[model samples]
Target chain A: MEEQLIECDVLCVGGGIAGLMAAIRASELGANVVVAEKGNPHYSGCGRRGNDHFETWIPEVHGADKEKFIDELLKTAKGEILIGRDILRAQFGKAHEIVELWDEWGIPMRQKGKWEFAGHAFPGRMMTHIKYEGRFQKTVLVQQARKRGARIMDRIMVDELLRDGDRVIGAVGVHTREDTVFVFQAKAVILGTGKCSRLYQGLTPGMMFNDGHGGVQTGDGRAMAYRAGAELMNVEMPQRHIGPKYFAKFGQATWVGVLRDAEGKPVGPFVSEPDRRYGDIVMEVNKLAPEQYGERGRGPVYMDCTGISDKDAAYMRHWHIHEGNVSLVDHMDAEGIDPRKHPIEFSTYPLRGGGLIVANEKAETSLPGLYAAGDEAMGDISAAATFGWISGDTAVAYARTVEHGDVEVTRPIIAALESRIDELRGRGNGPDWEEANIALQQVMTDYAGKVRNEARLLQGLAHLRRLRQKVDTELMARNQHELGRCLEVHNLFDVGELTFHAALDRRESRGLHNRPDYPFKNPLLSQAHIVRMEGDRPVTDWRSY
Target chain B: MPPIINPDLCIKCDRCVNICTEDVFFGSKKHETPVITYPRECVHFNGCVDVCPVPGAIWLRYPMPSMIVYRTSSDYRAPPG
Candidate 1:
């Protein structure tokens, strides 16, 4: 048996957009960096999946209409779309800089007519080339990182962040294939681990290979920060989206056209139009009145593609070409009615968005020398794609501010990481990571999902509290791989509990933080709720957004 | 027609619910499988078939006339301005 250890100025966990972007920036700043990716870095996370719409085609087609298209985002986030406006503008302003970086690294982005070739609007299609896809983009970035003298380890899972006193030094993770645990020492650690969707039940579109597809973001990075004593914000404001469930299997269909409710009733503009935004086509069914849909009570709204113009229908068929344009035909066959003739049945449910982490515009977590990026850290930045890129840039800039050469700040942290690795090795079979992981996922999906009440939140919080106690005691992992899973479960518990506590404390609904018991948005509670680990207990505070 | 469903083998992603044009299928955001609504409206585009990641969750059946009927703009239109 051999023990493996590595050293770098900065160690980034996860290889999604944030991690790759961070690695590149760190290398440019002249630091030894390493990235450990649990899966192939090139693939898209929840971000890149489905049509590549928002940041892609919409911008090209609309141009100044960008404001109008982005209006959907603002509306989705309940009119606070500009919450991360500063961060988004910064990210978009540097779009060309990022593209240049990608170009210099040999990654091909469509500059000419790739989007037109794909039948999308022309203006919105800049940087629209379908190179090896988002995952391949990660692959290319990782390769570029290697060229710049950064080391990369695949299939390595970071189980826990190594801490010394109040500051985080590094992390201890397990290398699956080798079945051995290793420690990495660093002056700074960047967590870009992405979202935790598998925490919920329904299938999310991207990265089934990773833990949370789109349901419950595992909240691994947040947990690590909390355990090491860092502040967290808005963990309870889960971004629940109502997506076309059938899109995953049947290729995408034109949903906006054939809107309907759960009982197969038509609740069109023929009913309530003023109260809802967009056409009745885009409004959620719950937003419509019962009389509008003719009775069985509205469960969800469906898009009736049958009523859309032929041109619109064709556009939809072309848009969903990835799944072979089977959706149009599926609509025809399943209902035995021509989509050219009838409206489709549809419903609305919940989808978890990139949960927000309460950091200032700079992507800095509450911890010193540690920054959170990507889905791992939640907040206003989570909603906007452009803002996500900006958060990455901000994190990189902040990381550069720290001079890694100053051992006075980083050396002890690295040493502490080594010690933590020894602690895991000593505590053999301490906890069952997989079961605990499932339990946490259930807690998030069942209680914290879509419709939430104080009772459910309290119940989930209590369960998380118990899980926290058991995580260090009853859970046991057979090997290093299992050990990482155990850590992920522990992390989810920590994150879920924080989210529940925040949800409970908020006492009112606003944006994604919906408490059914307090459905209406209370201006009194419009401020953001903040929490951080103070010793063994989590401390809470409030800040105006 | 019992209306098309292969319960044992549904990945339950609910792509069918999104694609259905006749208001025939629905599912919960949290549920694994979708519920068939207005089974009569299903036109059997067979789109749900290939789109389904799982092999055999949906069963295509004959369209029922009792369901609401719709016409595309290409077929129905105002005379002229």
Candidate 2:
């Protein structure tokens, strides 16, 4: 196959909110930019479906005291992780401005004269969020980026970053449909591939059929960065939460409704309250669920929406439909269940790989000319937006200082990547990729998932290592779809191993990294677990917050 | 489930087929009218309806009770005091 090469001043990989923002900022700064997207920019990443609210510290609404706001934000991190204070300050400082930009783009930020906002209640006093009908957020961002003159290459999955010495020059990807290889040469590269969500069973058992994070997020950015010798943090701290069991779509309904026992008695405060983080709420419920729903007890835990007025329920349903889960209501109706009558059943699931690609306030990785943003760069959407904005300007500034280098230096790197793909294609058959993937998911879900102990983690790590060897040599793809799945499994192996090692390294129980053996948060061990590749092995280090 | 396409109203422009990430719509040829080949894959982000040039060419049959909810594209404004 022939190789296709494209040159630009900035190459933004993974065209989610962060990548699009980077491309838009770079283009606005008069830099030639190209966006390589695994899926269409119009509908990719978590932002594609839309979000209910935007979290920003609007001084006018909250306060002008920036120091106080940062302190409050740090409190939410809860000593378990070292959130870059500089990044948090940068995010809060620009919060209102970004919100204004969204509003100027004709995206609604308020339903009425008042902005309905609520904190998860880790610190309830800070109501720095505003509800919005953001179903068209991706469309709006794509339009803005295009208007700023950033060319978008859709369905191009970037598999590796091209480096000359220590600096990243560009990236190499494959066109899933055209069967062509794409080589993007640029002065700067931005990775905004979102988080790794399918590392465990997603939402429900069979519902794992599609990655809960829009079927595209696979820790591709983390995997690529690790291979390039970049540092990643908090690989073990998984985002676990409670949701409607089989019908995870109705999980968000918990935010608006009240939690109840099987007998329909109110059990606890609604999730919208500002007293505790949602994760803590899930932990509380998980303890009570088995006892309350056991055969000896009433039945099953549920989100009781019975009290929600018809008008409010209508509004909620409209919002849910646009979030790409309209099937939730349909499934309910098919089963003769009604939110107005029956309470939705609940279960717990892990959301994504923990604290990811470590970068500075400017979103620049340890490696020069390379930037990380979105879930790969930060933990939340608000921080992702801030990182995206900052990284775009940073990349543009860096581009101005450097000139485009020769593409010949990348030939060896391109050849190596292509050979790997060729080897996969040459393999006739062995263990099925899907079967191996299920085994991988089963190992993580059984051991490293919600529950964790030294013994279980070690056992999971051994199983994952065996699975990784099988995947590297035996996995095969006959078509474009299978090829995409094969690549995803390859990336998942990298993430799974890192997650297990990180889990084993952390000796104390922190916010999300709950180890029954440790059972307590140790002040001495309050540091971020940093992981990086040493040849083929991942080495762990700690950095104090 | 995928957004239901009204064959009568559809101009067969193939806008929905091109925009959907799930490849929900499939046909023998590019110009041929496409059918919803994989409804289960549709997350229903509703980008297809927004891009469709023809009005009423596609509509989602939401579950009952939710059927009463009205879908509109207008921005939320403050109600008259």
Candidate 3:
């Protein structure tokens, strides 16, 4: 396959919300921009399925001081992680801008009054969320970007970053179906690939193993950045959300209802606070379910939406469909399960990559010319939108200062990557990439999952190292799809290794990094665990929060 | 659970082939009709159907109760179980 060279003033990788926003912003800023997406931008990343609401801080809606909103945002970190204050402030400060942009793009945000908003998350009474039909979020974004003269290239799976000295110059990716390598040379590149959600066993079984976000989010952005010597923050702290045990295929069903026992009684006190962490909520349910409903029925816990009004139920159903899980309505109908009647069984699943790609207030990574946004930059949709906006302006400014310098794609780098792909294609017999991936997930889930200790993490790390060896030597891919899978597994291995090592290093129990041995959050360990490539190996260092 | 492509409706544009991140539609050669080679890999995000220029060319059947039951049973073991 011949290497195709493409050049742009700003190259936005992974055309999810962040990438799309960046491309739109950059192109609007008068920079030649190209967005290389693994899938169609209209239905890529978590936003492929629309979200229930956009969490924003409109002063009229929030009614809180900017400092209070920032405090609430930092509270979500649970004192376990050090979130960048500047980044948080920027995201909060720019929330109204994002909402305004979405409004202009014809995204239907449900506003109650001149200042009143609908669907705020928790704790705060100020309605921060403007309920929107987000099913066409990606499509709207693509349209907006295209209207502003941004080039959107789909089916380009970027696997490696091309760097000149310490600065990232471009990226190399395979055109999945065409079997062509795309070498995108750019003055600036923004990565918006979503989190690594498939490292553990997901709600689904078989080939589509991880179903929380989408099968496509394999932590490609984080892996590429890590390999390119960019620092990743909080890699050990995995975020999990509670959802229906059997309905993982239905996408995220907001935990709007109460947790009830088999006796049709509320299992726990319903805390409607905005600052309530989903993890804590899950923990509460886990503890209460087995105790109250263990002997009463077969199913342990259920999210009782029975108390919700018919109008609310209808709204929930509409939100579910709008979120791209159209089949969910059919599934619910066929099961004869009405939210107004029976409760739905609940379970927890991992959300995104544990740590995020470390970036400054401008969403620029430590490596020059490379920026991150969205889940890759470690925030919710509002944060991602804010960072995406900032990164675009930042990249455009950076591009103005620098020329499209000659990016020498060294023979050694090309040969090494090609050899790995060839080896997978050529192998006749070995462990199937899917089976290896399953094994990897099993190891991670068993030892390094939600419940963890130092010993188990060490064991998981050792097991992961062995699995990495198998993936490196015996992995096989007969076609382009399998080749993509092989690459995903390779990225997954890097993520797993980094996560395990980071977990091992963080002895105290903090936010999502639950440790049985260290049952309490250590004040000393409040710093961020920064992971970077030291030569061929990864090293972890702690920075003060 | 692969998507059921209506042969009668499909224009064979291979839009489904290009759009699927799961690569459920296996058609390597140009103009080759996309086949559901890896049925179980389909997560049913409906990207194929969404991208299909022909309306109703690709559709998905709701997964069977037994399949959902089995998956939930196997995948949802509580932590420390």
Which candidate has the top score in TM-score? 3
Off by over 4 Å in 2: A75-82, A112-114, A118-124, A249-255, A269-299, A321-338, B1-11, B22-29, B33-81
Among these predicted structures, which one has the highest lDDT?
3
lDDT by residue (tens digit), candidate 1, A157-272:
67567665545567767664355656776667777776654454434222222122322235666676676677666666664433343332221222334355554465553332
User: Chain A TM-score per candidate?
Assistant: 0.72, 0.90, 0.91
Per-residue CA lDDT of model 3 for B10-74, tens digit only, reads 77788787767667776544565678887777777767777788887788765553133212323
Give the C-alpha miss distance for residue A420 in model 3, angstroms: 1.6
User: What TM-score would chain B receive for each of the candidates shown?
Assistant: 0.59, 0.67, 0.71
- For the record, the alpha-carbon RMSD of candidate 3 to the native fold, in angstroms, is 4.8
Which candidate has the top score in DockQ? 3
TM-score of each: 0.66, 0.86, 0.89
Per-residue lDDT for A379 in model 1?
Answer: 31
Alpha carbon lDDT at A28, candidate 3 = 96
Name the candidate, 2 or 3, with the larger TM-score value.
3
Model 2: fraction of the reference interface contacts it also forms: 0.11
lDDT of 3: 0.74
lDDT per residue, candidate 1, B35-71, as tens digits? 7643432333344554577776776653232132343
